[model samples]
Target chain A: MIELEGLTKRYGEKTAVDHLTFTVRPGIVTGFLGPNGAGKSTTMRMILGLDRPTAGDVRIDGRHYDELKDPLTSIGALLEAKGAHPGRSARNHLLCLAQSNGIPDRRVREVLDTVGLTAVARKKAKGFSLGMGQRLGIAAALLGDPRILLFDEPVNGLDPEGILWVRTLMKSLAAEGRTVFVSSHLMSEMALTADHLVVIGQGRLLADTSMADFIARNSRSYVRIRSPQRERLLDVLHQAGITAVESGDGTLEVDGDKAEHIGELAARHQLVLHELSPQQASLEEAFMQLTAESVEYHAHSGTPVSPQQWGDDWKKG
Target chain B: MATVQVVRSEWTKIRSVASTVWTLSLAVVVTIALGMLISALARSEFDRMSTQDRITFDPTFISFAGMSLGQLAMIVFGVLVVSNEYSTGMIRTSLAAVPQRGTFLFAKLAVATVLGLVVSMATSFAAFFLGQAMLGEHRASLGDDGVLRAVIGGGLYMTLIAVFSMGVATMLRSPMLSLGILVPFFFLISSILGYVDATKDVVRFLPDHAGSRIMQVVPPVGDDTPYGPWGGLGIMVLWVLAALVGGYVLLKRRDA
Candidate 1:
């Protein structure tokens, strides 16, 4: 378990992390979501005691990071893929870290095999691909088999196979009752893997809720309908007290999951319906909606800034 | 965490890198090879030396002349040992493994210092014996007054050079910047200042000048140095201590 209270980090005049308070509990994958420069990396560094917080406290398993006996055995973190020395072999890199925490040498080899890098374990890290380097970092984090694991952008440079492998690994680790905290800007990936989410925007907490609840609250889901007899469909819907808006693509959009009711009304009126589909907003759209205001870098390509119906624009673009 | 575990870990770190082997070997080869060459040269030119030069001729000190060049390699070794962590982005992982900043820094230093001492002592003994062989008749025996102290001091001097470099590297945190300052300061600037009459007094207090006094068996003619051999070494040690303290304080306060 990792607990942060009133955590803040400021660099001179600029505030990097502002009053972040959240608890990452065990038995689930907690996704840390934020836009670029949103302070996810800074917060992780503070939890490991690598960065000194400007104001606040972070604890791992109810004790300060430095006070933990063999801290690696309590919490393991993979902060960056290129953390190993270029000249040192993968085995030796893990060996030194293992030795530091009194972890045995055998465990180093075990982690090597676990990460599927045993064949290249003797090779220097400089020669490894970015995906391979990420595997090595994960091996280091799993060296002590700690109860809590933290990975920052774990699948950044991975192949499709590697991405699936990492997603499955994170889920299995969480299923074993370990607290798995991962940070990424990819909301689609988080929607697939994360059970809970802690989102931030411009260094401030935007939402801390379950994945299902977050999407339900921040996004709009509607039913899209297209018909040959548009006037007849509009009249039946107006009589039934249903309001429908005509989209730019000649489709009528009704708010909420009223597809079944609309479909029954169209059938009763003998309306020839070309299409009837319920459109549920993805986590990506929900994330954009939540962070639209706090996004630091805005693309100047005349993209719509409003969150309400930007999904259509995004799809068209 | 026990200090010994971190120490063991540091030993693994130092030994695993190729830089450790090549740098120390270069120091050994350069120190020994250069000492022998200079000793042979001095032996051939002995007859043409001035009477005053003959009076104050120090055979022990002449053999260790290669140290001026050889110590640069020691500096490189020391700088890389500490700065590699920062350069390769390994410091974050290392700090995460051992969050106690003091223990982490000191444990690495302790391991590197021990290795430096062992290699330096061996190189010192080799250079002394080989240079004496080249000098032939003018060779100073180990049993001679102050000869053994000078020999042992030669090893201590080399090891201290490496340790001092480690301290400075920790503070500077960049191999290029640390080497940029340390290499020229010790190799060119210190020697040039020592030669100039106006700067000679102040230069003596510098780490290298103060530390090298231990290798002199016979003081130079017109020598007016205020400190004894041990006193000079003590001054160098003080400089090392200051650098280490500054490094520790910075490491404690700054984010990794």
Candidate 2:
């Protein structure tokens, strides 16, 4: 498990990471989500003991990374895919990292085979494609069979098949009772792969909840009704706890009411309801709503800022 | 044993890189080729002299005459060894693998030191014999006084220069910048420093000045410093320590 207490980092005048506290439990894949410049990378670096925190501390398996007997075995990290010396051969590159962490030499070949890099192990890293370099980075991370793994943007530049492979690999590692924490800005993938979600924005924690709870608590439910007498239904829904408004077509839009509730209400009122259905919020929409604020370095383009623009302020419990 | 493995890892990394081979080869070729050309010209000058004006050319001098050019190439090779990690964003991986920064530095020192030793030895032997063959009459062997010391000193001086360059790389953390400053400062400026009385005191501590002093059979003309050959080389070693320590201090205090 990994834990952070009051952790913070300041780059000159800007506070990149604020005083934040959280825990990453074992036996599950925890996805860290944030907008660009949201401090996810900074936090991970602090966890790995690469960058010193301006305040507080981070611990892995109850000890700092430097205090671990063998850091590679304790925690395998793919901090950046382009982390190897470009001049070194793939095989020799892994060999050097393995040797530094006291890993046996056999593990080097095993990881190369696991990642399907054995074919190009003798080739220099400068020659490898981005995908191949990513594979090498993953191979190095898994070389020690670590109990805790940290992957920062691991799915970037991967093809569809490669993405699926990584998703499955993360799940399997967590299933084996290891702590798997992966960070990415891609919400679609996180919704599919992560059992737990840790969301941050503008250098502060926004949400720390199980995927199920997050969806259930934050998502919106609505009712859509199609009827020739849409005006009558609108008046009737207004009397009920649900809010209803006229749709562009001859239909009624009911807010905070499910299909069954609207149907029963219509039946009791003896109204002719042509259509009654529930509209559920997608995980993607819920995520946008939760992290509506704290986005830094916004891209100016034709695309609209997510509905999160509606939520100018966010809070976490 | 772990440190030994670290050293081995550093060696593999250095050898696998093509720059290591290219730069070291440049060190050898430039040293030998330049020595041959320079020694031949000096001998031609000796032959035309009147009998009374004959100034005997030192045999060891002509053989190791290429020290000036050889040192520059070795310096390039040394700087790249450490600086490439920073330029390519690989130091994060390196430090992550071996959390103990000291171990990493030690491994680099060992790999760079050994490679420097090997290249210097090759260039020394090749330049000495080739230059002697070029000198039709004036030839010196290892058996002569200070001839053995000078031959070994030539190689030793080149090795120290490489190590000194490694320290500069660590401090500067960029190959181009380190080599840019090191080359002109050592090759052009240090020798010129001797001409000005005010700069002479500081020039005594210049790495190439102290290191190049070892190659001289007798101190070069207009020399003001009192350091003998070994003591001068010792000053170069002192330079290596200063740079390594400076880098370490910076690495310790700064954010990774």
Candidate 3:
């Protein structure tokens, strides 16, 4: 288990993480969700004692990270894909980390097989493709067989097969009663993989709720209706004390389970119905709405900023 | 984190990379080969030397002349060993594994320093013997009064050079920036300063300048150096200690 209490980090005048307090419990995969620059990486670094927090503290397994006899055995992390030395072979890379934490040498080869990197275990990381590099990182994370695992954007540049493999690995690890905390900006991926969600925006906690609860609270479900005799339908709904929202294009959206009532009312009024269907908002829309204000870069059509321009803008802010 | 585990881990890290083998080999080959070549030239030119020049000529010191160029390779080895972690972003992973900053830094230094000592000692002895062979009748024997001391000091000098580079590299945290400063300062600036009458006093205190004194079996005639061999080495040790403390302080405070 990992617990953070009032954790904060400030880089000069700008705050990267603010008063974050949460617990990552074992036995489930917790998805950390935020837009770019939301401080997810900073928070994870603090948990691992990589970055010193400006305020408060974090404890791993009820002790400070440094106090643990062997930290990797308690919590394993894959912060980035290319964190390994490019000149070192995959097997040797894992071997070094394993030796540091007193993990046996056999664990290195086991992790290699687990991640399906045994074929290239002797190859230098410099020659590995993006997906292969990610696999090596994952293999490193599993080297100590830590109970708590933190992965930052683990699926960033992976193919469909690799993504699926990561998703299954996360699930299986969680099922083994381990604490699996993974960060990603991709909502669709989280929706399929995570059992719980801890979301942030502008370095502040936006939501910390179960997956079902978040979806149920954020996703909007409504009844849609369109009619050629719009005036008659409006009169019938007003007489029946039903409020209908006129969403342009000669259509109306009514909240709640009013589709059947509206249909019966329209039939009795003899109004011609062009379209009447229930509309449900997707998780993607809900995520966008929650993070709209915190989005740092606005994508303006026809005036697309080059990659270098985007980097410059980020530096300016 | 146990110091022993971290040391073992650092050993693996140093040995697994290609740079370690390449850099150390280059240091050995360059130092010995160049020393032999210089020794051969010095033997041939002995006849043309003035009486004063011949009187001041130290055979033991002459053989180790190649250290001026060879130490640059040692600097590269030291800089790469420390700065590669930062450049490749492995420092984050490394620190996370061993969160005790002091243990991580010191363990790495301990492993690298040990390797540097072993390789440098072998190189020093090999260079001395081969260069002596080239010098023929002018060669100083190991049985000579101060010859063994000078040879052992040559190994110590090379080891200190590499360790000093490691300390500076730790403080800088970038291989290119560390090399940019260390290479020019040791190779050109120190030597240039030593030749100028105005800068002679200050140049003697530089790490390389003071440390290289150990290889001198006989002082130059009429020379008045401030410190003796051990005292000069002491000055170099002080410089190395200061750099290491600065590096540790910075590493302890900075975010990985």
DockQ of each: 0.81, 0.62, 0.74
Better of 2 and 3 by TM-score: 3
Best by TM-score: 3
Candidate 3 residue-wise lDDT, A254-290, digit = tens = 8877788888888887888998898888998888777
| Candidate 1 Cα errors over 4 Å, as ranges | A226-236, A246-251, A263-276, A296-317
Model 3 chain A poorest 10 in a row by lDDT = A293-302
DockQ of 3: 0.74
Question: How well does model 1 score by local distance difference test?
Answer: 0.93
Kept native contacts, fraction for each prediction? 0.92, 0.69, 0.86
Interface C-alpha root-mean-square deviation, candidates in order? 0.8, 1.9, 0.9
Winner on lDDT (2 vs 3): 3
Show model 2 residue runs off by greater than 4 Å. A224-231, A245-253, A260-277, A295-317, B49-56, B192-201
* lDDT by residue (tens digit), candidate 1, B1-256: 9999999999999999999999999999999999999999999999999999988999999999999999999999999999999999999999999999999999999999999999999999899999999999999999999989988998999999999999999999999999999999999999999999999999999999999999999999889999989999999999899988998999999999
**lDDT over C-alpha atoms for residue A65 of model 2:** 78
Model 2: pairs clashing at backbone N, Cα or C within 3 Å: none
